[model samples]
Target chain A: SQQGEEDPQALSIQEGENATMNCSYKTSINNLQWYRQNSGRGLVHLILIRSNEREKHSGRLRVTLDTSKKSSSLLITASRAADTASYFCATERERGTSYGKLTFGQGTILTVHP
Target chain B: DVKVTQSSRYLVKRTGEKVFLECVQDMDHENMFWYRQDPGLGLRLIYFSYDVKMKEKGDIPEGYSVSREKKERFSLILESASTNQTSMYLCASSPHTGGKNIQYFGAGTRLSVL
Candidate 1:
């Protein structure tokens, strides 16, 4: 079974609209990180929010983590066509081996229209 | 900046043939990981290594093996390719400094086993 699962298998929105994606995990985690993948390319690290942090902001992106609910949400403000990509949420368990392996969610595909 | 490079962007191999995927990281990271991505199934970890000459099995390592003879490189091998193994393979590297465990990824290899 997967440790993390994202909501909304797919989403589509116009440019300048805000996009929101949600992720839920099954267990306690040390931190949760979000990544973005352009079509047919490697994933790029977007933002990370530790378990202790409730919310974080970077540029036009906002991430909120609610450990009590074991869920997290990512918000992209004023979205652009370049932001069209697949978004994934990964979780690192509270206790793990030294390697710090992460369990990834199925992902959310967001398409921004011009 | 960290750069994780995959040897091939696309590959094709026949069933029963040996297949190898190579990944190299330029940041001297101590951790390396291999994962396969499929539609709706997400990215499942295949193997990970924390150091040279060390390896560990991940969620789905049944048909894959990894080698880490050097700190900068990691390789995933399929002893005998199978058509079911056709998917996008990704390689990632992360440092073990402060538990942040942010990973850098390589342009995935889309392997088609026929």
Candidate 2:
């Protein structure tokens, strides 16, 4: 069973709008990281939020994590056509076992129409 | 700049043929992983290596094997390719930083088994 699962599998929004994607995991994790992938390309690291942290921001990206609910959300503001891509959330399990291993989510496909 | 490179962008192989997908990282990362991406299934980890000559089976490793003869290289092998094995294979490497081990991914190889 996959540990991380993203919601709103597909999203479409016009350029300059905002897009939000959510992810939920089944187990405890040390940290949650987000990544983006352009069409047919590799994934690019985005932002990471530690279990102790509730929210983080990088440029126009904002990530919020709720350990209580085992869920996280990513917000992309002022979206551009170039921002269209597949977004994935990966969780690194709590330490002690499975060190350096991450479980990835199914991902959300975001389309920023110009 | 961290870079993880996959040997091919696309590959085609016949059923029952031996197949190998190669990945190399320039960041001197200590951890390398192999995953296959399928639509709606997300990225499923097949194998990961924490050190040279060390390997661990991931969530889905039944049809694949891996080799990590060197710190900079990790190889995913399909002993006998099958149609069901076709997928977009992604290789990733992360430094053993002991904190926030963010993974850098390759562009991926789209393999088609006929």
Q: Where in model 2 is the C-alpha error above 4 Å?
A: none
Q: Chain A TM-score for model 1, please?
A: 0.97
Best by DockQ: 1
All candidates: DockQ:
0.84, 0.81
Docking class of 1: high
lDDT, candidate 1, A16-48, per-residue tens: 999999999999999999999998999999999
> In model 2, what lDDT does residue B59 have?
87
lDDT of 2 by residue, B1-114 (tens): 999999999999999999999999998899999999999999999999999999999989998999999999999999999999999999999988775889999999999999
* DockQ, candidate no. 2: 0.81
lDDT, candidate 2, equals 0.94
